[model samples]
Target: MYILHRTNARPPLDIKDAEKSDTVHFINSRSKRQRINEKFDAAKSRIERHQKRWTEIGKELPPQINRRHISVISIGGVIGTGLYIGTATALIHAGPVGTLIGYMITGTIVWSVVISIGEIVAFLPNVGGPVGLAGLYVDPALGFALGWNAWYNWTIILPTELSAAAILFNGFFPNKHEDFIRQSNIVAITTMIFFAIVINCFGSRAYGEAEFFFSCFKILTIIALIIAGIAIDLGGGKEGFIGIKNWKTPGPFVEFRASGALGNFLGVWSSMNQAVFAFFGTEVPGVAAGEVQNPARNIPRAINRVWIRITLFYVLAVFVAGLLVPSNNPDLRGSASAGSPAS
Candidate 1:
């Protein structure tokens, strides 16, 4: 509990008697500042009380977790359900060039944020992360505001992620009974959530081991996709050589908003939100800086590598997708199936 001091009540100073009452004027001015400070402290303490429960969750999280775990999480967490299929939407609205332009711009922005936060987290690698930093270095109001925003945002994201995983899985068996899929979805989400909680309960070392293997799997999967995409583009499959043919037929750029070159640029800009979604989790390292082994070494390293990895895995993958699939494809418009773009 924070103790707030209240100053004694005083009357307002009159300018007419200013020369005669310097002490009274000074006392009134100082008391006014103290009252303002007391009010601010009260608000700050109230916010911190609400935030205390969230910080307690980190108390059980051990600090032995190393660079490998944090690094992979930083890279892997960003690759979400959006990357798996929603990118198809971007391709449709914006053609290949537009999509590329949007991703590059968004990627640069993400990179800037990652680096800026990395520098701060490296300097003060505390457990509370952005939540703590906002109050400590910046204003408490900013911290309180951002903390609630993040809490609200992430709370919504969790269930959506579960449903998304189920949806992507259901895409595999298009002929399966909907009732069975619905039942299985309930089972899958429950099981996954349970396992995630169990892993987290085991503390950071357990998490490090688990995430290490998962990251390896994710990296390998992306590599495989890129390779397969290239193969498909170069006439690897029985479909014959694609070789930028789709790009030429539909034309590289699509006019989206108004007209001329400006519309085309806007078309590219339109996918910025989707690109932002795709590049969301690149800052896991900064968030988990307190638990990581070496803040200075690991955080900066992750920041540097994350951008390149994202470009290679995401940007290049989108490029390959554009080359292999046409922007005007009906699947992008949801005419093909309701489940997933891949399906």
Candidate 2:
């Protein structure tokens, strides 16, 4: 142990005094170094304590996902069946322009949230996922609330995705009886749930690989759609030269459950629910920060690509869907067999 002493002295005026001043300077720098070392040790201890707690509980998440896996997952998370099927309902409730506006607003919100989260994750990737982070940085109560809120959200979303898959499956057997359709839906949902459980049980590496494949597939699908949309807009479809005709004819907005400007406002407001659902998992990369290889480097890189994904996959997709399909098309409200504005 060492005692730090403070000295008050006049400026050095001669060689002998200069030597004393040098000694004092050295002492000050050594003290500063000791303070930094103490802070480093404290921070290291905190991280070790967290790791020990998780290890004791048998829940320590090992780093298994690489940069590519994490990046693709974040990009594809936002491009789900909700974006595929739910947007049709948005179009019906609010016209093309209104749906576009709703999606843009939601995208902006997602971007802001991910940017803030990215900075924190780059600094400290695993204070535990978002739940642990909230407890550490904010309040324990807020962390508890977020934990339960996430649980509730996932619970609902799981069933919703399963149901949406079943609906899409039913599209193949259009002429089948209602009873047969119901049975097929049950089978599809059960099969998917079973596969999901099996995949997760295989451990984090397997899960990351699986996500990487699916995310890549989704990315390709969106890219294809973007190209097709451009072609269709440029008079490649049967409806030649179909520029912004939908916008002009439908008048770019809808009146929902009422008449006049208030109704149109309501329409846009209601459409936000669909947009929110579409963008629900945009922060998935942040959630997986703990398991990402070299998270301090990878997490920020993955998050930086979020805006690109949003602009290309989501915003552009909505723009194309609006241009191609009219909001008034009764097919928008028809059975799930009709299959999305884009479809």
| Candidate maximizing lDDT | 2
**Local distance difference test, candidate 2:** 0.81
Q: Poorest 10 consecutive residues of model 2 by lDDT? A: 22-31
Q: All candidates' TM-scores? A: 0.77, 0.81
lDDT of predicted model 1: 0.74
Which digits, one per residue and each the tens of the lDDT, describe model 2 over residues 171-282?
A: 7776678789889988999999998899988877898999889888888988998899889898999989999999998879999888899888888887888888888887
Model 1: worst 10 consecutive residues (lDDT sum): 20-29
- Model 2 ranges off by over 4 Å: 1-48, 51-61, 173-176, 335-343
lDDT of each: 0.74, 0.81
